[model samples]
Target: MYFERAHISDGELLAFYKALLYPRLVEEKMLLLLRQGKVSKWFSGIGQEAIAVGATLALDNDEWILPLHRNLGVFTARQMPLQQLFHQWQGSPLGFSKGRERSFHFGSRQHHICGMISHLGPQLSIADGISLAHKLKKEDKVSLAFTGEGGTSEGEFHEALNVAAVWDLPVIFLIENNGYGLSTPVEEQYRCEQLVQRAAGYGMRGMRINGNNLLEVYHAIKEAKRHALHEQQPVLIEAMTFRMRGHEEASGTKYVPPALLEEWARQDPIQHFEGFLQFLQLINEEGIHDIREALKHEIDREINTALAEVSPPVSEADELKDIYAPAPSPIPPVAGAATHDKRFIDAISEGLDQAMVQYPNLILMGQDIAEYGGAFKITDGFVARYGKERVRNTPLCESAIVGAGLGLSLMGYKSMVEMQFADFVTCGFNQIVNNLAKIHYRWGQTADVVVRLPAGAGVGAGPFHSQSNEAWFTHVPGLKIVYPATPADAKGLLLAAFADPNPVLYFEHKALYRSISGPVPEAPYTIEIGKANLIQTGDDISIITYGAGVHWALEYSKQHPQLSIHILDLRTLLPLDYEAIREAVTATGKVLILHEDTLTGGLGGEISAWIAEHCFALLDAPVMRCAGLDTPVPFAASLEKNFLAKTRMHQYIEQLANY
Candidate 1:
């Protein structure tokens, strides 16, 4: 039937109607499941389905969609099987997450969909990276990112939009303004009248549309896609809509006024669109009823089948698998150890150069890394050697940089992100702790990104620049933490981090960057991530340490040559080599755990506790711990020396030796 009243073709209109009906039907079934205590929770995009469906339909099938938790319509448009969707909600083995993640926290690379994180805004920056990959590959594709009006309030939202604008990336930032951010009204969320208005500040074109109107959303997104693909520009589209239901099934809309709810019910997107279809002679009342009944029946059959399937068994061993990407095959160590000395910084730069040469997909990104060679000249001449595309100089946006690296990793590129200083990693902690660390465990995803942290407290860079924050990441599971003390270890561990199939936080000591020099193999070598280096073997006491503490221990042992102290340099903190630690303790019968981070919650406590529990009999005295004072690193050299336990190590070593 040709509908003269509707601008869209009959086929297009029908597809749009079915897309809308599918999610609505599934949402109704989900609610029924919730009532029957079959499903845990659900975030419904009831009135906002048009925005999800229309915006997704506007994109080409080859383009990527970074969906939000409520974007069920996007999954439907992407041809996600109804059975899989039901299985996911039912926590069955057939789901994408294998019952590991809840709700829409799963995504399929095969489907070109980046899964949603609980922290919704970080995906925007990741989408920017995906768009960047598309641009680099010279592919005529755009990445569509979906988020709610509430997500715009997050700093990541601004960071992502700014990066996208600055780079002219092909990304469409679609915002579903559902009037409330989990019961908090739009009036309280932001001062701007329209959410799209904020895009102008980021140098992007912005538009506002009626999200409930399918045609308006579809056309707006089509224009946005055109701008992104052709002009390499990002566009922000704010779809003004309402949350017809509560935030989730459990969170009822008691906060919503009855009058407002009643008003929205009258302007329901489905009913309004159905009326338009009727007016266009495309569908009558009987046909609409039949379509609804068919959709309901299909949804019921899928849900029943999903419920009947057996869920995957969860075991401790299964949980432990894939925590770290399988380690790459070991490269045979070069014959003979006598080699020319290379500075720590030189070793690191060489390692990066070698890794990039080995893997064409390896990309380096950070502030001032390209022309300026980074803050410490670690990446000096990298851009000139590798070109600007592979060695990117990004703005001073830590979270976005990390998130972009995550996106690049998802796109089959191994990215190394340089945090100008370790302390500044706090800015990107959300991406590190939540997204990068949890993605693998949640959905068996791999984020092969290495975050280079120039950490420690010796150069008198003060509190902001000098920090040994390895403990922070060591506490997080699914992350490989490596702190290399010497130039050789630095090069080897960095290469290993790039080679590993997991997210790695490589802590490079800032003070030792130039001061430390040692014979590093010119050939590329990888020091296993979980292994420790026995710097010196003695019989009196064992000093268990890492990073700059190795230097301190060496100096202390040199000063007190009478004390037979064995020093074990723990190169990898997370997957600690407890065997080496036990060997040292058994050989010496005394233990001293040391680190540069603060004493209270430093890695020393964990090591000490482990030794106390397992190797308590081997210890002659208490497992002594000497770490930095529990205070911010001071500025003055004298005070900084006192803040760190460097000066006190010798005193403790003497006391332990005498005892």
Candidate 2:
């Protein structure tokens, strides 16, 4: 029913007035509730209602919108049930996030809405990702993302804009240029005369308009959407508006000039739109009064109904629900599956080759991955086989690409991101920890994303290139961590990670890429994650290790042939394989945990503590660990050899076995 027209109608003008007024009234009522101690917090959109209403209404119903906390009109204009919105704000279980999140902290796939997180700029990349999905499917749809002037200062904002421009993604990057960002003035924010000018640097269309003009915002967004979809390129739009209230009720606006407030007050968007409706003879002053009363009554009833809806009793089950979706039902490996010898990297590459064929919607993104293959050649010849679209080469924007992966997952595509080095994951840490890992737990939405981390040492790659930082992500919830040692596991576990429905951090040791070779399945197969491989059973000490440490354990067993050493290869680090760990500890009665990460905060600390607590009576010796020194990875070979825990644990374990 909403269409972009050259000539306006009386009915359409009245509808816009109503749409603008609705969120204004709702925000006002929410503030009153906050004063009465009924609502927890409020971010008012009193003067800026026009921006949300205009843009959301202008976009197609099936298209997506990413709105910030101040954009309540985005929800109402999209026709989301008022009761549900109220219930969400009130943190009631009947709400969209089931009270797991509050305010605009949740998203609804059914509504095609992705709510904004506190980090304002990451969603720019997410919008780019969703737009990427539309382009991949050849669907003529566009996504609109909103941010404030302050959010534009984030590096992710620049990264996202550059990525969209390069890929020609169909997304509208709308900067809601509210004069202040949490009391910070526009003069202090940036030196540019206007934000839209930066669009030229990224090679995109740019537009700026007075956000107080509801008609202007509507028309601009409609045209921007049209341009994005038809031209197959993104557009940057800066809506020049003012924040007429405090950032939140608790944060008063003492910094804002009284004269500035008065200036913007006279330009109130809702009042101006209502005046247009009256002038058009669509509604009189008395009719305006009647409509306001009706809207107020409807909101009051919706609030009351939401309040009366009982919040479900808190339970432990609620606390643990949906942290992960069910692990994808895996394809059964053939009984006596045909096998062939392949290097560790070859197996991984082969597994990905089979995966690309199996999942047509699968995407592989990294730096120089397309025609050049990859930095490590793990994706050699992938572009020629899968085409440039599926096998993508990304800019040096780890943060944005990770966020885009989540966006792809949102639109029902499985995504894989290759971090050039494991230590480089620090660049994309926020996207991984705050965004990807927390999305599922906050909402019911799970992402099928895999980040391949080339981690480990002994290759003389130095600190930045050689790091086993899988422990960093293992601490985060809603993420699965897997590290494989042998060629077979390198292949099987990679396939298994792709099969899992949650976000997975797949760590591949650079040291084992070619050094390790074994007979691996010729066909696509998966090894169940969280299940340890029992290398050998012995009555002596149990060596609990993963990744490169598995090879260390095997070598130690050979050196100390007299000692009965039981080596357990923990392929999946997150799940811990508790049953296998218990079995190993019970059988050996002594435990040695080893890892390449530093001794201070490595995963071995947790594993050692767990074994100590659970298997105390069964222990013949104290649970010990051998991990890297508490310092940066050394650059020199002698120092690196001394810094590593390769043979340090062997002597202690032999003593313990003898003891």
Candidate 3:
């Protein structure tokens, strides 16, 4: 027999009490383990357990949640196995990260939680993507993400909130105002009096609530979800809570005033919630005591079992294992298929058109990509055909847009992000390199995203507008890089990029977009990602190149016909077509690695080193490199011509042939 509580049943209140109690017991035990040297570090959410517990319980089980480092209650409240959580903390083999990561630094797809990286605010945009997927699929699901008062200072914080509001995505951005960000005081973090005010500025409803009050947090989130799902709006919530301990155990709390610590200590959330329940008759004093003891005992047993279990096995094979998930096999191109001449840009556009008809789950996101049809007009009129939901026009928020694309892929949808110019990708570099690239290796989650990089120089667009940045992404693991050199390959490679389950950075040369025309397949097809296309063959010297340099190889061959060059177009930069490279090197002992990027630290350097190690004895000459000069792209055509690898660099070819 039980009475009603504030807008919740007595049973619900009892549920809240148990939910809040477990995380508290676990945090206290973690702190003990930290001192005892059983655990290396701990992020204690001791005083603010209610925020994580209450918010998680408020959401539907199927809805996604991205929790921060300090929010362990989200995991416990979801009923994630206690042993698995302990394993994650202790770096046991049974951990979410298979013991590669020690804290709540990784996420569980089964638990429907996306975990945050050290770059705190990036997860906000990732949450935007998960919600975007739900909205696109017409699923009645709202996504919630956590951030700290200090994390609000990040650029991603603004971008995520702005995009979510602009798109009217079903997202709940909860800001845990713990009053400090790694010892930086709240006063220093912002000029405004409250974080919620910024939400209004973004044209979204803003709410500020007492985070320590479990019922208030639960009700607020419950209502926020309702508003988001029913009305298709995003809400920003500022949960007023306190960080009861150091940012980590290493960063001591000596900066805080003694009186403030005492005040917050007296207002401990677990104690407050216990007292409130006692007053409501949801639980008597004995019930509260029994709950804490039982939870503590449960944690104690789980920790003991986890402690005895072995750590994850470490091996070089394990280190190199599963960086990229098994890519989808490419749909082979038709044999002797009917073809018509088309521009490089049109071929790309056609590929996207066919991919859309195929994937249905494919989403296009970038600045001005919908109605305006993208900067280069590659997606021109796409919004009319596919509609705005699928052909999304993102704001100038590159970071959030890219993060949202990652979220879309996490939920079994394929997404393409057009970085207006490849040079502009720096804005979203962290999301690409750290989040998208590392996600598969870090947590066994494949990021099925295709980032369309409109790259290359010689377009007179200058440094900001023109850059061959394929080398940057190629350096990172867990990403596929494709650089198509012809209209046919452009269409075929794009289809391939979209088909691949792993993340792909497809580089399309700006200079070749409309300037070049060739036969392209009328229907959808895919060229395998790692394979190279042999444009022409010769025995004297092999010129290995891709993208704009492929044209360079063809031009050099026409200019110096007597030399006889084997021109190879490496459509894929990463996975490097080493087999073709080896064959080229073996056939003609003289090889020249030509590229459009800078001479130093270009992909050529890595290719040269690789060839030297494997195919050195076969070489008749030093692997010559003719590349763009190491300087910012000059606007002056005269200056840029000197910077690029042109036919005039015939000396290198002659020298290689003679040697």
1-659 per-residue lDDT for model 3 (tens digits): 12224567778778888898888888888888889988788888888998999999999888899999888899998899888888888776688887777698899888899877899999999888898888877899999999999889999999999899988999999999998898999999999988899987988888999888887888899889999888899999999988878999899799988888888888777788777777777788887788888888888898888878777567777767778788778787788888999999999999999999999999999988988889999889888898988999888978898899989988899999999999999999999998998887778888889999898888798999888888888889888899999999999999998888889999999999989999987979999999998888898999899998888888878977787788888899877889999988987888998999988889989999999999999899999899888898888988888888873468788777777
Runs in model 1 deviating more than 4 A are 1-8
Predicted structure with the largest lDDT when compared to the true one: 2
Off by over 4 Å in 3: 1-4
TM-score of 2: 0.98
State model 1's lDDT: 0.87
Against the true structure, what is each candidate's TM-score? 0.97, 0.98, 0.97
Our tally of clashes for model 3 stands at 1
**Residue range 219-274, candidate 2, lDDT tens digits:** 99989988998899999999988888889888988999899899999999977777
What TM-score would candidate 1 get against the native? 0.97
Q: Encode model 1's per-residue lDDT on 1-659: one tens digit a residue.
A: 11132367888887889988789888988888898989888998887788888888878877788988778998998888889888888777678887777889888887788898888899999998888888788888888888898999999999999999988998999998888889899888999888888988988889998888877788888888888788889999998888978898778899999998888777677887888888878999999999999998988888788778777676788778856557687564588845669999899988999999998988899999999999999888888888998999898899998999888877788899999999999999999998899888777779999999998888999999998889988889999999999988989999999989899999999999899999998888888989999999999989999999999889988987887879999999989999999998998888899898999999999999999999998889888999999999999999999998897787787778778
Report the number of the highest-TM-score candidate: 2
Candidate 2 stretches greater than 4 Å from native: 1-5
